[model samples]
Structures are given as C-alpha cells and as structure tokens.
Target: MINLHGINCPEWVSIGGDQRRFDDSGKPVDPSTADRAERVLATFVRLSSKVSA
Candidate 1:
C-alpha cells in the first residue's frame, strides 16, 4: 500500500489573493491565487480514467 505516513499538509480551499507580483529575482508570485482549480480538475479526470480503465 502507498503510505502517506508523515506528510504535513493542510486542507486547501478556494481563496482570494493580491495581484501577482514579481520579487527582486523577477520570479512571479501570487500571494492568494485561485486559478489552479481547472488544472486540478483536469489532472484528476485523467488519472481517474487511467486507473478505472
């Protein structure tokens, strides 16, 4: 069995965030972005289909 024995992760929910900004290193960061839901749903569909079929 795949054991997730010692992972520390809080439950995630939809939330708002400030506008995306770049830091000193020019790395884009979103303090509170919620745009990942579509990506998550797509991945779930793909994985579920593979496992079920």
Candidate 2:
C-alpha cells in the first residue's frame, strides 16, 4: 500500500482468483484500462474519505 495525501492506495488490485492486475507502480498493464482504473480509484478514495470524515 502507498500513502497518498493520507489515502492508502494499493500497490496492486486483484480482480478475481488468479487474475491480479496492476504493476508495482499501481498502473494497469493496458493504457486504456489504466486510465479507467485510475478514475475509479480516485473516485473511491474521494468518496471514502468524505464518508470517514
């Protein structure tokens, strides 16, 4: 996990059994997929922080 402005960002994400994705830099193998995943992760972090706060 990585600390991003107090948000704990995962190094990698697992989609399902034996289907782990993302690299050590937290980027998906495919550029398009990475972009989408980044957006989703950012939204999740934003919402989760708001909820916790």
lDDT of 2 by residue, 1-53 (tens): 23545654444344543334667896566665666667778878777887687
For each candidate in the order shown, give its overall lDDT on alpha carbons.
0.49, 0.62
Candidate 2: TM-score? Answer: 0.48
* Model 2 error, position 47 (Å): 0.3
- Please give the RMSD to the true structure for each candidate, in Å: 10.4, 8.4
Residue-pair clashes per candidate: 1, 0
- Report the lDDT of model 1 for residue 41: 57
Q: Which pairs of residues clash in candidate 2, taking residues 3 or more apart in a chain or in different chains? A: none
Cα distance off (Å), candidate 1, residue 20: 16
Highest-scoring model, lDDT: 2
Q: State residue 11's C-alpha deviation in candidate 1, in Å.
A: 13
